[model samples]
Target: MFDFIKTQVIGVTTPTVDFIPTAEDLPAFCARVSNPDNQKNFDTAAGLLKYCMRVGHWSVFDMSNIVIEIEAPRDIARQVLRHSSIKFQEFSQRYAVAQNFVIREARLQDTKNRQNSIDTENNYLQEAWKLKQEQVLNLVRENYQWALDSGIAKECARVILPEGNTMSYMYANGTVRQWITYLKVRDDLGVTQKEHVDLARKIKPAIIAHFPFLEELMEK
Candidate 1:
């Protein structure tokens, strides 16, 4: 039901079992771990990886790397930006076009659960809300364009745009260890914002692809 949140993981490069090894360095490292003398019995890289996670050593996870690009409403963008550990380069309204993409549906506030939403019972009313949001956003866009044409600075003109209606995108760059911390909190069901949880779920599989034992690590 939530199609508004768009994201992608690009330029992914993950580490092998070694903490500081190059791409060509993993097989030999795994072999050392699997050496008969050591009796570690790690038959494969994946096995050694499992051991690393099982031991609760997160530093090894720092070897895995990725950059995630996300296109979302400003509200969601604000939530994502709260993750101070990860580096982010966001689309700036001061420099670029401010695409005011409105979120049309109005979610019903749950009285018992503050900061949570429930489905509105009336589908017809929801449609009306969509139309009204579109009308307001169209006016906003027109005024924004007019200000730009009238020689107003983009930085100044952007003040007219509503934070909830604007679209902001960003690239999040970090290691798997950083992301593990992010996912643990943002992916939790207790999180009031469903969009953040949706994004975490979507990117988890990509993380698992590089670190096969990560799902088990997260469990621990």
Candidate 2:
């Protein structure tokens, strides 16, 4: 007999956003060039960056760029691609096998907001949903394997995969201005998807760590 009650619940892989080291001081250097009178010193550069951010001089931030690699589910990855300013090179499912599948706790749809959800209070319902989700994912995995075994092309077989499957982008590059905008919008819990918000939260720390000058701007 299938032990639905005792089945181990599958969970989503925690998303990661890592900063690829590059010209960290380039933004400040470019900002300094914008004003020939500006002194050539670390304090002056930091002050210029802060003032630019405060006064909405976003063009200076575009002088330098950051590269990041993201590991997230297909659905969240799609959301990340919606940022037009970011250049991304995603993993090709047509060539590689799709493996990781994310299974998250089910939430009740928000009655007032079409784009939001509210947590469910019923433990039994949550557990039942988890069981069902696991079963469906198991079936999906089996079907995918069967298709491969039957000599179906990976591109064709991948169509049957769910949006919850994990995907990665080895190279995602964007300017500081673009990245700041991306974080401001996606990190808002009131409007953005919970999982995507979590991913944005992870990215912020990396940005601040590399370019400490931007910490005040990031807070705003």
| Number of the top-ranking candidate, with TM-score as the measure | 2
Give each model's whole-structure lDDT.
0.71, 0.71
Model 1 C-alpha lDDT per residue in residues 1-220, reported as the tens digit of each score: 3477777777566343455344312432533544646433334556666666566666666665678888888887898889888889999988988864856466787788776777687988888888887788888889999999999999999988887768788999887668888888888754447766777877787666655556776665
What's the TM-score of each model vs. the native?
0.80, 0.84
Model 2: residue 107 alpha-carbon error in angstroms: 1.5
RMSD of 2: 8.0
Model 2, runs deviating above 4 Å: 1-24, 37-39, 165-170
